[model samples]
Target: MRWEDIKRYQVIEALLLWEGKLNARQLMDYFETSRPTAQKYISEYKQLNPTGFEFVSQQRAHIANDDFTPQFIDLEFSSYHALFNTQGEHAVTSLVETLPQVHRNISPQLVRPILQAIRYQLRLDIGYISLSSPEFEDRIIQPHSLVFDGTRYHVRAFCEKNQDYRDFVLSRFSGEFAFEGEATFDEAHDTLWQTDVTLVVCPDHRLTELQKKVIAHDYQMTEQKLELKTRAALLKYLLQHLRLDIYQAAAEQQQIVIDPECRKLLAPYIN
Candidate 1:
């Protein structure tokens, strides 16, 4: 098989292993592939997912054979150790906290389950508490991805009751899960837009040449000013990173002209 084919097969393997047994319809959506193509891969995957077996005939679905073992799993202990040190500055500290001395604070039990749900695209019914809202609320979410926010873990997912995509603080997901369901793949839910954020960076003339180099890449120098095009969601982050409040007429208006609904959705952050 070609490298691309091997990579595609790997995606299929990970999905099946993560989800346990995804139906043909779901598999088609997940892989963006035809039924025949997915079926061909599924036939091959059965031999691999040990527990995965074909349920052929009229009322057909994939089933786990007796020999099936959950080989597809979250990062193992060794894998966790290897990744811990290199993750970031807080990596060593977080690793240490996860040890027995601080076991309850960074609960390993909670960490593994949340990681598994993210890896497998599992739907989770969690009792979560927010700082703003002291009361714990029951939430049903289809976990889609993970984002590292420089510090703690954050899960990006589609919250069913909220009827929109939202980022949840992992630590706030404190209570026991009420229910966990196999995930149904979503295409539109995953196609996040590529956001473009523009900025005007006029490094003050008083600053030295090194200072100009420091702020150079994030901006473009004109005759006496700089214009920048960056991919970001919020203007605040751009302003903070550029470390300049310089403004220009064209730079202000050149922001992408997206749909009204999209603008409305982003207004709270962008404005």
Candidate 2:
């Protein structure tokens, strides 16, 4: 099958896995395929993985099995959010009444070169506007990976100017860039990206028992705490996104706080 067709099949599998169920009409609407084409994709998927889902006549949908496993996509929160946040007829029913969105100023011209550099392991000379500097500076970086931290896109790269690995915000980059020399660094040397840190978060102990319980339920915590594993480089952004950086806020006001033991590890990133 064509690569696009394969991707659509994977999307169907992902929708079923995350949303628990989906109908043919939803698939048709999302992929802009005809009814027969949608059915064909479903039929082919079912034939390949019989145990993945079961048809429910009452709901007129295919419900994912309890042991359903994703075939082509990683079960990442980003993937889940991307599928639901898309503006389309088959957008998944969201738990929240309204989804928050960030208006980014990223340009396709800037992103395309970064992606190409990453793919080819090349260096890029980019004009970047950093908060620390008042003016945009020309810097050479070896692009490695792209990340979306729920708000903006970031490119993790080895900066020749700083002599360290840093995240360059995609939108903050000026549209002027050129291909430099070959890349000197690889993903293996990125210590922050290679290290896995577990963030232990729990409802603030200052809150009442009832309030703590509510917070735990909202975060789907186990044993009153939630353990999230993330790259050390990305921990700072994650904490900021979850509003856990405001350590001075009252328990009731913040609702959640990081475990004292994990705070020391996150200090460098948080600061």
Q: In lDDT terms, which candidate is top? A: 2
TM-score of 2: 0.73
Name the candidate that leads on TM-score. Answer: 2
After TM-score superposition, the amount by which residue 161's alpha carbon in candidate 2 deviates from its true location, in angstroms, is 2.8
lDDT of 1 by residue, 55-119 (tens): 64554666545444444334234433433333334422143333332222346665666667777
Q: TM-score of every model?
A: 0.41, 0.73
Residue 270, model 2, lDDT? 67
Clash tally, candidates in order? 1, 0
Write candidate 2's Cα lDDT for 122-166 as tens digits. 999989997898588998999899999878889999999889999
Model 2 misses residue 216 by how many Å?
2.4
| Deviation (Å) of 111 in candidate 1 | 2.5
lDDT of each: 0.54, 0.84
Candidate 1 least-lDDT 10 residues: 251-260
Query: Candidate 2, clashing residue pairs?
Result: none
lDDT score of residue 260 within candidate 1: 44
